[model samples]
Target: MAFTNNFSTSFHWWDRIFGTDTKYREYRARVKAAKKAMSKEQQLEFERKLMAQVEAEGIVAEAEAEKMSLLGGNKKSKV
Candidate 1:
């Protein structure tokens, strides 16, 4: 029973590592195939959408940081 438990645990560890690598490769391949399948106009549209998403995330992050700084500075002043 102990040996079986140890074997199962080790198997899961290796499986997780290899499984993630396989999944990443599959994701990259799918993305490459989809990009190849797109026309120039479609590709440009996709890039524009991606950049918009990235910019939105950055703005959100900056706003969060500014809010946290304001809250932190206010607390220090009250103390």
Candidate 2:
């Protein structure tokens, strides 16, 4: 959720057929709002907890955690 994008790659079919994507999208919005309400330390703690939850659920790959910007774009290098 902190990664700022909504997707389930490793188990995409599970996410689509079972409909977890909708719930995950909603949860992401909540995550952003929650972080906005917390101090820096609290936000870090919250993200840690959130990361654990998502990792356990297998919603995305470990690579998603390292991304600070949205995936797939052409801001500086447009083709």
Candidate 3:
């Protein structure tokens, strides 16, 4: 359906398995387009809901620290 780059030369798995293949690229593009369409506000709302659930379980602090570390921030000092 959607054509972008040279699917034949871009992908190399086709020659190894069977022949030329472009189906994977189409599937990937569709998934990426869907993700790009999601609004930032929707993402934030989902995060808020998730954080509230974690807070209710008394693990919000731990979860937040983990998230910060993943984003290259320093974890809490043991001292």
Alpha-carbon local distance difference test for all models: 0.54, 0.63, 0.50
The alpha-carbon root-mean-square deviation between model 2 and the true structure, to one decimal in Å, is 11.6
Output the worst ten-in-a-row residue range by lDDT, candidate 3. 1-10
Supply the global lDDT for candidate 2.
Answer: 0.63
| Candidate numbers sorted by lDDT from highest down | 2, 1, 3
Candidate 3 local distance difference test against the native: 0.50
Q: Model 1 over residues 1-79: C-alpha lDDT tens digits? A: 1111122454666645556334334444755776898998987787677556656655665566666685642335555
Candidate no. 2 TM-score: 0.44
lDDT tens digits, residues 1-79, model 2?
A: 4222335577767776766577576667978999889999998899788778766655454444534335533334346
Per-model TM-score versus the true fold: 0.46, 0.44, 0.27
- Candidate 3 vs. true structure, TM-score: 0.27
Question: Which candidate do you rate higher for lDDT, 1 or 2?
Answer: 2
Better of 2 and 3 by TM-score: 2
